[model samples]
Each structure stands twice: as C-alpha cells, then as structure tokens.
Target: MQTRSLWEHTLTFFPQFLAALKEHAPRDATVAVIGASDGKFVLPLAAAGYRVIAVERDPLALHGGEVHLPGTAHAHATGLIDRLRLEDLYDRVQVVEQDFLGSEPLDRLCDAVWTSCSWHYSVNHRRPLAEFVARMQLLVRADGLFGAEFMMPVEARHHLVDHYTSPEKLSRHFTGAWNVLLTLRTAEFTERAHHGRLQDHTHRMGLLLAARTSDHPHPHGKKNA
Candidate 1:
C-alpha cells in the first residue's frame, strides 16, 4: 500500500470519472488501463465485474517487487487480489507487461481506456504530445470513452510525475464531439517532505475527465442532465 499523497494529486475525484464511464460504457465491458500500475483502480473495477487489461512495463512497479521511485509505493494489484480473495476474478483481468506506446494497435477491443496521473510519462516519451494522444485515441470503441486524472504541472517538469496536463490543452488536442466533463484545479496542495530531509512542495493541479462522442448523438431518451 502507499500513502494518500500521490492520490491527493491524482484521482481525487474518482467518482466523477466513474459517472462519466457509466454513461458511456456498459457493465462487464473491457477497459484498458494505460499506466495500470498495480491495479489501484483496476482491482476495484475488476471486483465490480468489468474486464480490465492492466498495461504496465515495469515488473517491480506494477505488482510491487521494489519501489523504484523513492517517494512512493508501487502498484501491487496482485497482492490486493489475493488479500481480497479475488483469485476467481483473475479470469476477468489481464496484465500486459509492455511499453504503452509500443504495444500493438488494440483497435476497438476496449470499451474504455483509463489511467490515473500516468499519462504524463507516456506522453513525454512520445514527444509532440498531440500525436501520441491521437494514437491512444485509436484504442477506444467509437461509443466508448477515455477517462483520466492528470496532475497539472507547477513548473518545468523535472521528473516524469512532474509532467502535468491542463483542460485547455486537452480540449485542444481532442477535437470533434467531445466533453470535458469535469475539471477541478486546486491550489496550495501542500505535500510535506516524506522524511523531513526534502523541502515540502505546494502547487496547483487539475483533474480532468473527457469523453468523445460520435460527432452528434441522435437525441434519444433520457439525456444525462
């Protein structure tokens, strides 16, 4: 398990992301987690019966062998599964140990794609962020959604986790019928130095949930007002 600080800067508004998913995707649908570190959301989602594909490159980080990054504990979705007696649920989940950008095109297999504060690392590696995002957009089914929580950067990104995203840039990158469903920017998010050896840091970060539509949906029954 890990401290809640990473979460504080990550998916603080997970419920909203769920609401957006429920509206666009269906029950037991297959979803791919881009950074799918140790199943933070993947485990819970799987327990709920949704088929989850957790994609991670690092052996240690994904299922927790050793914490590569000193300031944080890594994903251990496997541990969570056994501890919770979720071995039966294993059939519904797949752990793909591969680099996100280099993976084969998973055209239209997933009903949705998700990640929590993990996009920055992949996007930075791609360079020219929009191009990378466009490639990622290929994975989702047309009726499906892509939901994520990104930490907005305070200054130049010194580290992968430091890379942040904003609603404006996200909106710009995603053209066509899309919705920036939720955007929350909180300030003075103080993170005390873990051991008092490092200086505490405070800055602004944004949580964004966006979904793409088929340009225009035939105005049908019950609009999710």
Candidate 2:
C-alpha cells in the first residue's frame, strides 16, 4: 500500500514534539499514550523511564511493521513496541489493544497523557466533550500535563478525514477542564495523484497542550500532593 506524504511529515515531527513534552514533564511520571499506533511515542517514553500504558485498537497494526501501509501505521499500536527492542519493558508499560471510548478500566493515574491525532475519530465524537475531558482528567494527577496534535482541515481528502477536527472546535472542548498551554498551527503542502493528475494542496496542522485543572480522586484513593 502507498504511504501518504502527510503521514511521513507527521512521523518526522513526532519525535521533537514528544521530546518537548517530556522536557516539561516530571521525571519518572506515569504516562498514558492513546492512539499509540505501533508504539512510536510509547517506546521512546519507556526508554526515558516513565511508566506508560499504550492504547490502540488493532493488534495487527501493532505487530505488522514495514509490511503495513502508512495509513495503518497509527492504527496498529504493537508495531512500534516490537521495533524498539524494549519488549521486556512491558512489565512497566501496558499495551491495551482496545477502543479508547469503551468501558475498559484504565486504573493508573498519570502525570502525562499523550495523543497524536487520534481523538477526532473516536466512535463517540458526539458524546459530550466535557465527559471525555473529565475521563482524561481523572487519569492525570493535579498539575499533570496533557498533549495532543490534531488535524485542522476535515476537508482534506485522506483516509484519516474521519479523525480530523478544526482548531476552533477543539479549543472549546478543552476550555473548562484544562489550561491551554500551546496551540501551534503549521501549514503543510502535499501533492496527490488524483485521476492521474497531480493536485497540490495545503492544510493546517494544530498542536495543543493543556494541564488538568484540579485534583481528582486517584483510583488508588491517594491524593496528589
């Protein structure tokens, strides 16, 4: 399968973006990576010594390495984990191949939550954004960090169109639950072979960072102090 140029660009920038988030994160903090897709962000975080739980939906996407198409890269959470040579880290790192909106229990409270362009495509976009933010907030301790990158243009003719959200819309989603730290919009250009004609287009990429507003009941019944 052919890989989209946009996905390539995203992969290139992910390391730096994640590193920035890590730099600001507390040392040895618990982290949860949603839409982990091959553990690209998970492995590096593990190598950095943070307790991490990676959630993804497709098991094959995690294990099928270079054999899978770029569109499937983020769909598979296991691929990146296996590639990092840190499989034994699973003891400290958990990989859950399931939908994020489902009722599965993610029992650990975390200091950081990382999601790379995955929230917009969840099965329950219509569900109250507050509820979703509340769920994530509960997973993170007071003063913990949350970071995500979202696609701004839903009109982009790509396989991930179903998962894209505009900056304006996402901002409102986080308004009450967290403080917005950063919103960076970068313009990207791509040429697609459509109908045997190369069509060049540009789209916006948005990166967002927020901090959980207040302390919530940690699953372990211990307060974040």
> Clash pairs of candidate 1?
none
Instruction: Write out the backbone clash pairs for model 2.
Output: 38-76, 38-77, 38-80, 61-76, 62-76, 62-78, 62-79
What lDDT score is found at residue 80 in candidate 2? 46
Let me know the TM-score candidate 2 reaches against the reference structure.
0.70
lDDT assessment of candidate 2? 0.61
Q: Write the per-residue lDDT of candidate 2 for residues 107-151, one digit (tens) a residue.
A: 666788877766655464666545655566566676678777765
Model 1's number of clashes is: 0
Tens-digit per-residue lDDT, 1-225, candidate 1: 232222222325566767777777888778787776555677667777788887777664454343323365543223433422344556777777777767764533577777676656644555555655665566665566777666677766633442466767666766675656667767757765532224566656566666767665422321221
lDDT of each: 0.60, 0.61
TM values, all candidates = 0.73, 0.70
